[model samples]
Target chain A: MNNHVFRPLYLALAIVALVFLARYLLVPKDFGAHERGYMYGWHRKGNENEWKAVTVKYKTSAYCKECHDDKVAGISSSSHRFIACENCHGPALGHPEDPMKLNVDTRRELCLRCHAFLPYPSSGRSAIRGIDPEVHYPGKQCSMCHNPHNPRIPTSRS
Target chain B: MNRREFLKNSITVIAGLAVPLSALEFINPKELLADKPGGEKVRWIFLVDTQKCVGCGLCVMACKAENELPYDADVSRTWVERYVVTRDGNTLIDSPKEGRDGYTSQKITMGDGTSRNVRPEDIEKAFFVPKLCNQCENPACVQVCPLGATYQTQDGVVLVDRKMCMGCGYCIMACPYAARFFHPVYRTAEKCTFCYHRITKGMKTACVDACSFDARRIGNLRDPNDPVTKTIMSGRIGVLREEYGTKPQVYYLGLSREVK
Candidate 1:
């Protein structure tokens, strides 16, 4: 019942009341709208405009067909129809406008990426004809025997 | 005590109780904004056909390129782990450059400072296991995050709210898969988002698109027509570290017992 003891306790209670009042006014009504659990609105403070939106960089193969109809037609009808041009050619960042010739990787290793036979059990989805790069053509580049865009050998080019 | 003093004490106690009780009522906001009224809730699932993966490392490179993560061991968003078990009870595990560079048959130095040449024929069995955030339905990262910076979407994708994250590193420690990491540049805890940006826009993830062997696929588990749905229902699928009880959305087709 001492006045001195009650003074500091009253001030502490008043400060706590003010803090709650400030939180009530400041926190968004739908602070934890997207989340579920006890600490839902823990991120509501100081995160109003926080999402970092990214632009799409790796576009679909359909994007390439718009400009190069001839190449698209060639690839579409060939044995390599499922393969996207960018897969072999890399990302098409700056193309016809910049007039930069995309590096046509003619290395045998490029073709062997998919065609090299692995000893593991195939899932039947990836049971495409694979060859040992060493025995198939000693030092010959894959492009020398098979066209990259069409991928069929000269015997099956038609 | 006098009646006047007794009444004053009762008033003080009533006021103290009312203040905190009223404050608790204001804490939880009402559901003013309803999430799209009748939109179907999407349940995403990622499938990995381990047999189809030829250790090509294209998916690893594609994930790095798409996320714009630096080409560093500690910073990779996703990586491929090659497990080579030899006939003589020797198991070799390596993920050079986080498997960003395709693996080659070469001499690998062991922990004992001894070198061994690994040839294709000498090994009893070898397989490539690609690893990324499991995006668990019951994600520990989401649960342990001190700040609600990490959350799982209704569609089952776990994401990090970069701005909200306090870089506490608690979520990184909580994750059983070792998927989450403190990003060096952003200084925020970062992990695989299941390509949430692309998946929401009806596009396959960068890894799925880049894989030529159909090694990886993602689809709506609710849609019966999706081929991936059939693969999930029928295939002998297994998840990584199911004992942790995370209930990961990602499933592997030919998961061997050796893979952790």
Candidate 2:
């Protein structure tokens, strides 16, 4: 062909090369249309590892059983067997090392979450024993009269 | 050949090559192109017993503590709503502080000026329904994310890529359940992940562990011995917004007709 055809072809090839080079530089190395789908699957493979590496803040009661078998056994035998120790004591992710102690939430509001009477017969909440907070010891703390570990047995003040 | 005919044929060949080459550049050849997103070894499912929920906000508090969210912030990853139906067939709904504080009063203030006390005798029914991210099989949040910041894991949990997210609100608006919210601190779109960090370590989600009433449970569908899986297989279950067809993984037991 003459120089006329060759000129246009060379210009097109140069533009294509420029676009490809820009894309290589702009797009992240880890970016991909993953196995999920082409339309919505764009993601960085490194993100999965980041998410998996996130620190877990809450530990189940099983973790507490290792050291505090007495408290674990006490709760397991009581009506509060299902309750995890961390629920009332706060998250024990960094216990005995950093803080050395867990704060026990003895607030009346904490206990009232389950004990407050709603009178909803349809709801299974009524199945659990509830007391009328208004009439049942207005200002006194529940822990003063009742031991949380074994709620059935009232705490005997020494 | 004529210059025009030669030019047209050459352009066609170049265009065909360009399309596939660009596509190949974006798609990694080494990655397995599976028909499904996750493997068959694990499929996580969440079950909520609405009957057992007592409007206790422990789960909300636990989620905040576990996720390191601002405790005083209005937005939360999970919340509980109270629904009260009167004998007159009027439905009333309220979620005071997202039920972060348990419902202290039986009285609900009217839209006007007055407050009506929902006594057991006057009210036909009252119940609490906890709400959280559905972690849908076909997630709308993932579909609408412009940057693909939101994605579902192989085990069926949906997570946000905080580094990838550019604080765009597209996924927040696209969510049918209003499960996603802008993080007050990070300023990125955030939602529930079913405690992916804890779950992968063989521990319960913070919310599930906080629920002393046995209101929430998570299970793997692949495990025959999983209690939550057994309950799902044998019990009557329901999901919210079935019309949306998001195929939400969270199932509700004893779901009332009034709940949305």
Candidate 3:
């Protein structure tokens, strides 16, 4: 092909590549103010059009203590209370709206939902450890073998 | 200013900053942002005297409150597994059929192996083991993480990074004592961190502080005056699964021959 004929095509290709790169360079991550989809910015879901885009303001475990003084204080004294509620339970949209109504049928199901695969800030394992949901924990719930509140798992060694 | 010059300058600046920023995010990441304190670690461990556990189930309460677990027919996060190991070292575990809250019932087991009821006296010659996270020195959960999810702290406390954890249950199986439990919403593997956040911040573990008989103890194994170590060193302490080699930091003092 003639150099003159091919010059415009070459320029067009370069412009397209540059535009793609520029878009990648300019776009910041788009996350909602109330809700966080995944691990990095996990939070409760809220109206996308209703609220402005802002960093999700995570409430502390203590914030939960304000209304749940007894439960929070109990949790504070308990070993598991050290962990925030949302940390274990996920960022619930409105837990305080009706805490009593909140239900996780299987004891292990709630915990294993996160801890079995996803870990805390100081995890001891990886992201995807490949645990079979159905067969892994059978009739015996997680508490049968371990305790959420206790730092030590109970045993019959002695 | 020319467009080419602006693009070149901005790209160079952003590229330089992005690499450093991402690196920092990975290095000093926040475990929790809400009312959280510095995560600098001090040593943490749990010491249980099986002889002291009376099966009252206070640690169970501690677990429920701490983890905010729901109740009913499901399993309790930290339930007391009470049973009598036979003369042959075979265990016969007997737990309350009811979840956390249940009425006192009679001892009646269906011969067909369905649901049964048992009174306190029916549990003859029984010992209770309150199991939770072992907080091992070499945790398999931390080793097997695919996304750098669960990690060990500087002071040797093992815990999950819920944000990083994908809720895969490999850590649950890797744990020989079945110490790990899954989080319901976050969908990650979790277990006892020896109350890592609190213990490191000058607070007692939930179960330890709540225990009436002092059955649960937390202390630095390295400390000479640490009562937990002294108690274990003084008495014949038994570490579970000396064969699995998880190097569990939890030590059991006063192991009975029946349990062996």
Which number leads on DockQ?
2
DockQ of each: 0.18, 0.41, 0.02
| Per-residue accuracy of model 2 over B17-129 as CA lDDT, tens digit each | 88865433321111211224345556778899998888778899899989889999988899998888988898988776677877656766565756677778867888889
lDDT of each: 0.71, 0.81, 0.52
Candidate 2 lDDT over A64-127, as tens digits, reads 8989998888788899888778878988878878568999999888888888888776676667
- Candidate 2 overall lDDT versus native: 0.81
- Kindly report which residue pairs in candidate 1 clash with one another: none
Across all models, the iRMS values in order are 3.6, 1.6, 16.3
Report model 3's TM-score to 2 decimal places.
Answer: 0.50
Candidate 2 reaches a DockQ of 0.41
Instruction: Report, in order, each candidate's fnat.
Output: 0.21, 0.55, 0.00
User: Once superposed on the true structure, which residue ranges of model 3 sit more than 4 Å away at CA?
Assistant: A1-158, B1-41, B73-77, B85-90, B97-124, B257-260
Give one digit per residue, the lDDT tens place, for model 1 in B6-54: 9999999998888876433311101111234653457778888877777
